[model samples]
Target chain A: MSNKEFEQQLQRSVAQLTKEIQPQRDLWPGIEHALNHEQDSQPKSNSWAFQSMAAAFLMIGLFGWLGFNQMQGGDRTEQLVTVLSEPYQQQKQRLLASYANQPALTDNWQQQVQELDDAAAAIKLALKEEPDNPALLKMLKQVYQQQIDLIERVHAPAWQTI
Target chain B: MQTQGQLVDAQEHFAERAVLNLIEAVKAGDKQAYQMLYQQHLGQVYALCYRLTADRALAEDVTQEVFIQLWRKLDNFRGEAKFRTWLHSVTSNVCVSYLRKQRGWWQRMFNLENSEAMHEVAPGSAGEVDLDSLVQRLPERARMVFVLHAIEGYRHEEIAQIMDMAVGSSKAQFHRAKQLLSEWMGYEQ
Candidate 1:
């Protein structure tokens, strides 16, 4: 059992080894689901960039008009903000729904997330009163980004030591 | 379940034209083309991941991750590198990132006592055992180096870059891996 002979024997054994090992399960289904999920998650138009810009302008104008009236003291900012942001709300809802059942990484992640959701709710409540506040819109976007980051981190791939 | 290396080496690189065509279609957002590529590469990718991670389910999971990444980043493939080479690079990065994310405190704690850790020995006679099973029994860093060096044909310097270790470390780990495999084979005899 000299080192040289051992090395030669190990080399021979490895040379005979198969480099391709088939998975026991049909991995195609999982891959298919992921591909489809990605397609579903993305905005579904080549013109979405222009469309989103146009939509954003329209929303800003509408919210600005509502806020102006509220300053003059009218009361429909609630309904208007909801109408303007309906699409984004649906997108967020769908995002939340997809990962709803995934396990969280930290024990306090849910509570931390709950605090973010509460902030989001409070921001929406304020938007209903003063819908055109740029600061508020920016805050809402940040909250959304945080939620997405949190969920993605929780579901991130890890080494399967097992 | 042919290896991608076999595909690359076959007949002046088998299916180079077909793979190029698939890449074109994939760049155009063809899901079918992507799936075709996935099927062609899954076994090799899974085997690579398994050797790196030493777990079947994780190998499959990482294989799926590799494809998902390929689909997302297919537009960045400029045909400068061979698709197989590009793919192995991507799989290597995906495995590296996977290892990084698993360094969470709780996971490290759990793995210390985890019964199902990669060191689990399957019940079988040594002669009946597969090379992959034996490779998985090597220590983690050694297993990664052996697969990247021996099976994947990476030079120690290249493995150093991929695994982010010194070249000598890669060489040493590879030798350690071979020695472990030798011991296992001697036991079988």
Candidate 2:
């Protein structure tokens, strides 16, 4: 054949081969089965997807529940701290009230006694504000005799430890 | 606009009722329509696949996958582009993704005698075309362009989009394909 006709023949051949390589007729049954099974198998796949989604949602809900409880626990601790501090504040006020009630005398002996009582009350108030404070209580005990001496001169002369 | 062009356009387009019917049947879970549609359009899709993979079995597998995916996604088909065009796009995309996954398969499959390459052909009264030598010799990208655009009737723009190349590149590839075949057969310039 002439080259021009040969080229045309080649193009024709190429086009012909394109048509012949279709999927085999035998595989069509398998292909059909595949399609039918595809129809049959879809519900199972959907069920799996739904189950996974539900599991995910359940886990999320569990975490949310735990987190909410943890936040509530933190709030409870804050409230307890506030409640526990109130009594210390009240005790400090009571100590100040008692000190205010004591009167001063004209003599230095009474004045010295009143000063000691004032110091003791102040120390006690400080101790109540910080209930675990041992330093202030220790200081208060060191000067306990001064108040006792004044009180004994006025009333019980034989009281020794004050 | 042009009266003569309008007449030619009218001649090229056919009522797409068969495609629509098959789509409806497949949507209704009719396996018969699925098979008929497969039989009717398998050549075009298979040709597209073979050109992309250059391996017959892989092409067959991709063809199967394309049909499977078509069945699965049948409900998503709206009447946008022509059904055949949409099928081509889907087939081409699936072939590309398959190529990415099966690089080793491609290397091994094409490693044999170059004479065994699959050829793109048209339906005819004759039983088969002698394609082993012609297809074995054409450059890969050129053969794909020729098969997609010339034999399969895809426009250059469509081939470019499907193959992810520039439109100019598809045009150039097609021209080079025609030129190469003509030279291989010793045709006149």
Top DockQ: which candidate number? 1
Model 1: DockQ vs. true structure: 0.22
Off by over 4 Å in 1: A39-98, A101-162, B1-10, B103-129, B187-189
Per residue, candidate 2 scores C-alpha lDDT tens digits across A17-97 of: 545456553445435545555544455445534653654465456546645666444444333333333433343344335
Indicate the worst ten consecutive residues by lDDT in candidate 1 chain B: B104-113
Off by over 4 Å in 2: A1-21, A29-162, B1-15, B80-82, B104-133
Candidate 1 — which pairs collide? none
Scoring only the second chain, what is candidate 1's TM-score? Answer: 0.78
What digit string (tens of lDDT, one per residue) describes model 2 on residues B1-189? 699898777654544766787889989988788888888888888877877666676677667667767777778779688887788778777776655444422233345223333233322222244454454456666666777776667898988876778999989988877665655554555
DockQ of each model against the real complex? 0.22, 0.15
Per residue, candidate 1 scores C-alpha lDDT tens digits across B90-133 of 89878766654443322332343233433454443434446777
User: How close to the true structure is residue A153 of candidate 1, measured as C-alpha lDDT?
Assistant: 40
TM-score of 1: 0.59
> Candidate 1 - CAPRI tier?
incorrect
